[model samples]
Target: MQIPAGPLLQTINSPEDLKKVPKEKLHQVCDELRQYIIDVVSVHGGHFAASLGVVELTVALHYIYNTPYDQLVWDVGHQAYGHKILTGRRDNFISNRKYKGLSGFPKRSESEYDSFGVGHSSTSISAALGMAMAAKYKGETDRKAVAVIGDGAMTAGMAFEALNHAGVADTDMLVILNDNCMSIDPNVGALKEYLTDITTSQTYNKLRDDVWKMLGKLPVGKNFTREMASKLEAGIKGMVTRSSNLFEALNMRYFGPIDGHNITKLVDTLKDLRNIPGPKLLHIVTVKGKGYELAEKDQTKWHAPGLFDKITGEIYKKKFDLPQPPKYQDVFGHTILELAEKNEKVMGITPAMPSGSSLNIMMKAMPHRAIDVGIAEQHAVTLSAGMATQGLKVFCNIYSSFMQRAYDQAVHDAAIQKLPVIFCLDRAGLVGEDGPTHHGAYDVPYFRCIPNMIISAPMNEAELRNLMYTAQLDSTNLPFVIRYPRGEGVMPEWRRPLEEIKLGTGRRLREGKDVAILSFGHPGNFAAAAIRELRAEGIEPAHYDMRFAKPLDEALLHEALLQYEKIITVEDGTVVGGFGSAVAEFMALHGYKNDLKILGIPDRIVEHGTLKELHRECGYDAQAIADAVRQMRKQPVSEMTIPA
Candidate 1:
């Protein structure tokens, strides 16, 4: 586990330095970079196997293309660590994915080489196409645009849309489909098989090469020749290739089934394709966890490994102080399994987050009841709606941010039809480290507006469990979303069995006189802390935990308004259309306008930072809450302003 001294990585301050290095020395450079990543990640712990898998691809791309000028858009951007190391970030690699440090994803602000910012999946092709189209519009022909997308990301409908659009646009762009046969788990669907068919076809390549050579030799007019040649080449190749001519039909030229790990082959093929025109695709075969034995053997576990020994590749060990309750996601997984166990009609679904959402646990426990529908978020929602038609209870577990992709389906299929689908939304607050694109900030606002949807936020693990149980038994014939935050749940001493919590009722946590603090979701903990601080300052604030967003506790809210002159509503969601806004709407409807303060996420895209930092920035942290209450108390009685 001894890392090499500085000089090797120090020399690679930018992609230019990587380009300057002799190709023969790339293997040594890659070894140094890999070891550096291993050493750094062993302690810091970031996307492990993903970075390992892309070492050669990163090297070859940087070495081949003049980056910053030639765009390199990475899909998902988790595997951009190697690219980061080669592109002026080697010095700060240790600080990667930390608070106030380099981002885990490709950020345009971080470096010029990061041409496009990415965190979510299936955006590279669309973004690269934009860059390509822009380049064409500006009449800049020399520079190229490339998108390095994962096989898992390719399953997303957006990626297909981008591919479809790019093919017809007739712009010169390269899409390197980095096929490791895994997104989180292995990719599914007919497209995966189509890709496999193309990769395995030997005769297709021979026929493609002969046709391409013949097409190149034909002397039509210069401008018309390349277009006509590409069209003819694609047509003949499509006929020879038994696989579906999906990309070719879009008018993009297809290349490769090439070995991605082989540095020489990747570099040589890329160099050859540099002269080719129009949209080109290079389907590269790679291993998800390429180098390390442990990673290679268990790619899923190593996808983002914790601290591990470099030699034996065993993860660093630590025991929990208490018998750790399963992760919130795991609790949901087990609950789903339990529900399915009781009812054969219960179905479990996830949008490519089987492991992250702990749906894999359900899949293992009740394989017949669970399904991972790739990265197709929209598809998962509609599919659940379809399943619900047969009187099945479909529990769809998707991360909060990803759930945005299926908004139309949530409204049209589930909410509109009044389907009994339980949406288990994991990471429903400020998700740490992975940054803004992964933040679960918008789910509350988005799901709240739906007509037949009931949205509930649980304060503790017990409440989460109870909510899920209640949702199952209620037979509401409506869509219910249980939004929960990431990481460890609060260790509350009190325990309760699955009791039916009244559908639209909220419970009071604390009683005080001067002010009322209404909190939603996980932000209730912060409100509690703020209450303690307010008490110390002689301001006793009443605390109410509003469990349901849609069917808000009007009785509890009315009681709070009557008792407290000043009230504040807090949530870990956007202020514009979130919990605070719901309360505001309630007050307006009843014509009860007391001094009200709303606190939540602001109307801007928050950047990558620690959850604590983000919460503080958004004024949802305890200290911020305490300070706001103190400031409100200090305002003169005559000048005390209430928001309309």
Candidate 2:
């Protein structure tokens, strides 16, 4: 992709510069902005189509409203790339999602334009309303707060919760419902455009003002004219567009189903909405990947295609030096498809991550069995539990970070009920580039305290399959969790014949008498590499792949404690309450005193980078583990230090 020759866009460093541009020339500016985004993202590889989808909306909002003061809170932040670019990050946008660079999502610390830091979806409405209510409390009655939420994000319960409050508060705020996929009504045509112009005209405005004044006078009667005025507005809106009972029933003044791409119409609507106040919801219909033809056709795949040619729209084929193993998500997708073929009770569920989790394969193969539950994680968890009660083996796939949203449901609905819902947690460790909010760093520790839960992390693709297979057996009654990392599995030929790994058990990969290193999940693979280096130095260390974090291979751990008398536990998650802490509790309970050290992510947030970089920072990389073992052996365990 060639750099966009954005003459107008080049001069506009910030929204302040955007305000200086003539309203009539905004369309050309928008075209240049969209192309600029394409040029940068095609090379840099951040969120692609989402930013493309909301170009005109972003332009119109910034052009119409006074941002950094009026405060436009973007939902999810993927669609806010245009907002970021217009708000003075355009020149530095190439470094987006890079290590210690600009965050992919909206971050409050990054810029003042980002009023609310957003990474998780559907929090925009709640955050915006809080700002609105705060503005009201501080007596800034004219301050405007707007939430630009996607139709996909609206499926979450939190969005509705905020709407429910905003509707009743009668606060002067706007909720822009960005309907990019599903349409409440067709885009406003020429006829609707004429009606909108007439409604905004001087003669029509004077007539409406006269009618409102007369109604105010009739308000001498108790609750009469106020009710009549609402009915009048509803009746008028019913003829103009589809009457949205959802937003309207909550007492929000509903106005739209407008053409989001039509910059003239968007500017007019937003300009009019500024004066007409009190909880208004303007539903604008937009096409995802509007300008880019290829992206518009396949919005989902193009949502975050790593690196692609801007002109041809072809994803750059990664040339690996060696044969590449499939992603862990593909392993889960294929394994579940295979399992479903064998068992009639097998079913799949994902909360808006069918494709991301690779469950879309099963979705295509068995549409009846597999379900895409939208962005409702809490509902997805309880729904799986409900399915489990009916004797169905539900394989509910969710990202580890997303599962944090449904933690209560996992505990109350699944664990407390002792339901056999197989939770397939993808991205169970440091997910690079998405940054802190997206890192899968807390699943093991979070679920450890819950009863009737079995948390297992597989070291490779084969263990993932066997563990998944083991969870489906008729004997399995408890809620099972199988967590694996984001990238490719270590094993290339991993789909071996299904084997049942015994519960509460672990397997030894290396043999030693001096030091025993027990590792869990994908981090155990690092220990494998570390052991190879140790052996080259004629110092062999026992390496145990402790598969289950919950039922910690008591018999194997007991034997290791007696034989080696020195131990270390490593995991991909935090050390505070994670796998290492579980082993520590076991030692405390049984009174087995061995010189022990724990190595994993420390008690702080790990930033975005490659897994190798992050693993080294957390002191669980191959070299770090080798160094730790040598230090533990040479010095006392207490004297040995691990990088935080």
| TM-scores for every candidate against the unseen true structure | 0.91, 0.90
Query: What are the per-residue Cα lDDT tens digits for candidate 2 across 411-476?
Result: 999999999999999999888888888999999999998999999999999999999999988889
Candidate 1 ranges with C-alpha deviation above 4 Å:
1-7, 200-241, 317-320, 492-496, 532-539, 636-644
Number of backbone collisions per candidate, in order? Answer: 0, 0
Local distance difference test values of all predictions, in order: 0.84, 0.85
Give me the overall lDDT of model 1: 0.84
Q: How far is candidate 1 from the true structure (C-alpha RMSD, Å)?
A: 3.9
Candidate 2 overall lDDT versus native = 0.85
Cα displacement (Å) at residue 3, model 2: 6.0
